[model samples]
Target: MHVLVLGAAAGGGFPQWNCNCPNCHRARRGSVHHWPRTQSSIALSADGKRWLLCNASPDIRAQLHANPALWPSELRGSGIHGVLLVDAQIDHVTGLLSLREGCPLDVWCTPNVHSDLTSGFPLFPMLDHWGGLRWQPIELSDERTVTEFAIPFLTDISLTAFALHSNAPPYSPRRGTPSCGDNLGLFIVNRQTGQSLCYAPGLGQPTPLAMRFLAAADVVMVDGTLWTDDEMQTLGVGSATGQQMGHLALDGPNGMMALLDPLPKRTRRIVTHINNTNPILDDQSQAASALKAARIDIAYDGMQLTL
Candidate 1:
């Protein structure tokens, strides 16, 4: 399986337009240590030809422009077979609009997220006027059971969805009840090679349920939204901690780093959906070094891995 890091920054991206925080400022001033990143999203391919998008981030157009593999052919066909949404956040779903240039699209998500998109945000009605859009509901089950779904032309791949703690989107009518399928995580397994991967860019917690899923995969990419719980407040970016914003911090005794430390050494662990205010973006920072020593990776746009 081939995985592409289309974009690595959270909602607003690195050096967010309205943000003048230290990190964003450094990136704007072209500081070598502070490179810019687009909002979070990833692309996965089983045969290296047809691909499935993890999330259609707002930066999808730019991200696609930078990736030649995702470019359309002369016959006007896109390599993207479908999109799997983990949630219905604006940053995650807005890019679907950009894809409405006449091609049919298949979108897979949980029922609540599907409802939020069709009703709360009403994306389906608008996009339908442009082209065909199929909304498929993914079934969630226990970590031990692999919920199955098939990607067109990738018969050798099996896709599954797992329940995650959903803080729900701010616009969601169904808030607080994670069991409503407001959020989810995906596990992609190669039926041919037996290699598998897990992706959860919208995690609220690395619960035991999440851990069980991670344990079964060879690669796990999860939320890396903040460095510490109070990072946004200290940086004057926002009043909410990472947890409050439906993310897990990278540091602290109860943080994702410590929680993920016990995973098998062979399991490749990486972090994504990072906020612009996090200091870990700086390669020279102690936080980055600590993560490296702990065998964890900080994702960057355009990075790729073969699992």
Candidate 2:
């Protein structure tokens, strides 16, 4: 299994155009210690030729440009074989609009996510505009369901979607609707290699089932939205704590640091969907050192790993 980190920063991305927070400030200045990243998204390939994108980030064009192997000149209008969405967030699904010009694509997502995509963005009308495009909705269940799927040019792969708790409050059906189910996570296994990847980007809190999946995986790319609960408040950036923002805080007792400490050393763990305010964005910062000591990688935009 070859995994490519398309865009590793959280929602607004590092050095978010309008923000002047410390981390963003340093990133704009091109400080060696501060690395710039794009919004969160990834691609997985069973063989190097064909790939399946995990999420279609708003930065899809640039991400594809950065990784030419995935979108060579001859494959430009052909499009990827499939796209799997992790949530209904704007950053994750908005990029689907860009795919309209390419070959009709296959989109695999939860029913909730599909609903969100279909109803939320009237401007895109992706589902209706692209005749060749298809939406394959995966109904998440408490018990895992395994199925075989193919990513063009790659080996057949096994996919599993499991129900997990949503950190966000329920969206009012009366007011408006949500595009994706509030609860979701994905476990993708490569049938040929027996290697697997567990991805949960908008993780609220770790549940027993989530932990079990994390424990069993060879590579775990979980959320790393904030370094501390009071991060935004302390920095005068926002009123909510990290938890209140719907992501796991990395510091303090029972935080990400504590929860991830017990995982077997062999398992490769990485933190993606990182926030702009997180000090770990500054490689020389203590937070970065702490995470490195724990063997947790802070994701970067062009990072790639072969399992």
Candidate 3:
């Protein structure tokens, strides 16, 4: 499997237009320690000929243009097979609108996420006139049973989605009361190699099931949205703590670092979906040094991994 990090920053991205935080400021001024990143998203391919986009970042247009591999071979076409969305965050789903350029879009998402977009956001409805949108609901089992699904048009790749602890989108009626399909922990496997990847880009608190998947996978690309629980509050950028925004901060005794400390060394760990406020964006910062000491890699745009 070929995994490409299309975009690696959190919503608003690094050097957010409206933000002048120290990190974003440095990034804007071309500091070598900081590099600009787009909103979070990735593209995967079992066979390099065709690709599956995991999440559609708001910057998908630029992301696609930046990568020649994703360019269309013919005069008017796309190499992208389809999209598999983990959730219905604005940064994740709004890119669908940008793709309504006379080409039908095939999308897969949890039914609850579909409902939120179809109702409150109405993005699916609004996109029907142009190019048309195909909705492939990711079936969830009752009693919280996790099921494996083989996405159509992709070979030797399968996905198993487990329930994750995270808040629903604000537009959703089930915002405060999360359901089975509210958020997901995706375990993507390469059937041929038996190597797996556990991806949880938005995790508030850890569950036994999530921990098990993380420990078992060959590579774990977990959330690194904030460095401390009170990062947002201390920075005076946002009133909510990292936990309040459905992110498990990497610091503290009960943080994600401690959770993965006991995992086997063979299980490569990487962090993605980083926020602009997170000091780890600065490679020379203490947070980045700590991440390196812990043997965890920080994701950046265009980073690629093969399994």
Preferred candidate (lDDT higher): 2 or 3: 3
Residue 96 in candidate 1 has what lDDT?
92
Model 3 residue pairs with clashes: none
Question: What's model 3's TM-score?
Answer: 0.97
- CA lDDT scores, all candidates in order: 0.86, 0.76, 0.87
Clash count, one per candidate: 0, 4, 0
Q: Pick the candidate with the highest lDDT.
A: 3
lDDT of 3: 0.87
Query: Where in model 2 is the C-alpha error above 4 Å?
Result: 75-79, 123-127, 130-132, 141-154, 167-180
Q: Compare candidates 1 and 3 on lDDT and give the better one.
A: 3
Task: For candidate 2, write residues 140-174 as lDDT tens digits.
Answer: 64535444444445576776676555542233241
Residue range 1-307, candidate 3, lDDT tens digits: 9998999999999989999889999999999999999999998888775888888889999999988888889897676888888888898888888778834888988898889889999988998888677888887533367688987766888888877888888788987787878888789999999999998898778888888888889999989999998987888898988877788999889887887788899999999999999999999999999999999999999999898
lDDT per residue for candidate 1 within 152-213, as digits (tens), equals: 76668888888887578888866655454878888889888898888988777877778887
- Per-residue lDDT for 198 in model 3? 91
How far residue 131's Cα lies from its native spot in candidate 1, in Å, is 1.8
